[model samples]
Target: MAGFHVLTGSGSTIAHPKVRRIGVSDILDAMRSGLADFWDRPSHYVFLCLIYPVIGMILLTWASTGNALQLIFPLVAGFALLGPLAAIGLYEISRRRERGEDASWRYAFEVVKSPAIPSILAVGAMLMAIFLVWIFTAQALYAWLYGPTAPDALIGFIYEVLTTRQGWTLLLVGNFVGLLFALVVLSTTSVAFPMLLDRDVGAYAAVATSARVMLTNPLPILLWGLMVAALLVIGTIPLLVGLAVIFPILGHATWHLYRKTVVAPPERKRRR
Candidate 1:
């Protein structure tokens, strides 16, 4: 089915893409296509995504010292919330390649010049707000269970978490809370970013469309979310270095997934 291009009061055309219900196989195909895109220029993606692991390492160091030790898990887990923002450039790269255009790494920054940048930044801000709230919620959850005082060192905190009842409770409740946040991020953002890239729809409409996609195809979207979480865990295991590969693949995959989930606006016919 074709989507609509609605003219607004200000005469701006807003594309409301039609949503499609997808399946497990579609998700797999998207990832496969994404990996192929990454392999087309692995070095470029690596250079683009190196900042991910560096940021992870910084968060690890920050959490390892002082009272921030308790934040290590939260910092790592919170990556799901912010990962989409990090991948905006990758989406552009994939989109360019798909259209048979030049997809050099520098072109990734072309998003900065897009008319949709403001909307993209608005959505990005919303994600940042969620990330901040998640961090605060993580801290509050820990404080409620074990008080404001963090352990003297990383190992001591590890012992407290592994050997104590409150630690067990924290792990259970904290992960449960984190899951809720991840789901919200997944439902709202799975298609939003890429849709924004492909269309000039406002942030509100893009987010609404993404949520609609989630409702229309819950199982596949949730499965994709779980897969992303699993891969991110593996990526972080090698001291966060693996994300140099993992993030780009997921990033490129997300663009392909968006293509599968949303129908693009029809082309305009030229008059004879």
Candidate 2:
């Protein structure tokens, strides 16, 4: 299979990185690798992974307000749009572990000191902008359909959503819009963050490379996205407590996926 080639600049020079075409097997392999990484020293991830449950709690708190009930689903679903940013540290840990180095939780913070922090933050800002847009769009859709006031109770709201035309319309249209946003995030960040961490490529190149990865292996990338979404939903089912495990596995898996998709640059030959 032909690989997708991305031309990225590293300061004074350019590098052509090849993104290999992957398959379902590769996805499974990556997941297994991720699981192994997580199990290696699961304790190392305990503190590092708490951020997810914290965010989940915050979202739940916000959604508890009667007026904000309409935002419950949107807030939870749209959180996935920022998953790449949340996993930056996990990627660093996986990177270190792969190199047989210290993979302690504290070392994950080392990404803060990386030269690519600017690029990583740039991409994170872009995802945050998209997440905000998704939230506003979902809110507008609900307001247009059901008016500004929420149903008096949670049960009544659920009943109306299942039985009423306006409710059905809101569900369909809102989810469709959310899916579009999700796909955009998946395509743009599938390998962008990890690439930035592993290379000197600027934000533009990293994003371009990620876009190419999606274009070249759309099926595999989409499958990977679905897997991530499914795992997230499972994690959310137990009152967000499951995320401590799910989040780390997914984060590590993403780094492994990046490794499988992108060919590492060749080592430079030094003159004797």
Candidate 3:
């Protein structure tokens, strides 16, 4: 039998016969599958997410001793480094499901056990670099506005300007910059790791393909990106406790999204 090919909505081919284009319903189904798997193996999921608060508290405690703004550095670094590792568990689960195999904690670890570790770590390093740049920019802006030492008289003046028309405008500009940064990295790397795991493709190809997928399905991808952002924001509310569920669900859903997007090359026909 000829292998089936998954294609884009425009009929451009995507994945191999083993992988198919999943619909919105498939996304929901995958989420359900992920939730079921989570409940069945709650300990594994909980353990991974627990790192968030432990790290958050440690940073917060240190920040309390100094300027609160200092905590942002460590917090961003922690999320950048540890977040992907936590999501690896769900990636494994999704991989097993894709192969019609049992989804178990063992399968989750199997996802992390890859010769592609160095490549994934390299991708992680690139992400960290981008994040650090943003952090430094924000820090520089904050320092410029407040300064290392300012008189009490300057406080009123700064407050007036900060709350005025120009302040709002600057705020908007700052937010737009942050949003663009988030979107660029988010869209580029959303399916990056999963793609690497699913295929023998290099990390560069995985990241590039993920960006192409976003460009091809801009609106849907934008909505998906916003959903992830909102969820991550909410997950941070309860001292980061919500991450246990949110991270896993997002990770599994991402795998499904990836399955929906990229196509594998067509297999050559065999002579009869």
Question: How do the residues 1-272 of candidate 1 rate in per-residue lDDT, one tens digit apiece?
Answer: 01122111112554466899899999999999999999999998999899999999988887886569899999999976999988999999998898888999998888887666777887899999999999999999988998888778888888888899998999999999999999999989998888777776777778888898999999999999999999999999999999999999999999999999997768722111
Runs in model 1 lying further than 4 Å from the true structure: 1-15, 268-272
| Candidate 3 clash pair list | 14-263, 14-264, 15-263, 15-264
The lowest-lDDT stretch of 10 consecutive residues in candidate 3 is: 1-10
Clash pairs of candidate 1?
none
- Give all candidates' CA lDDT scores: 0.86, 0.84, 0.61
Q: Kindly give the number of clashing pairs for every candidate.
A: 0, 0, 4
Ranking by TM-score: 1, 2, 3
Ranking by lDDT: 1, 2, 3
* lDDT per residue (tens digit) for residues 131-200 in model 2: 9999999988988987888666777888889899988998899889989999999989999888888886
| TM-score of candidate 3 relative to the true fold | 0.73
Q: What is the model-wide C-alpha lDDT for candidate 2?
A: 0.84
State which candidate has the highest lDDT.
1
Better of 1 and 3 by lDDT: 1
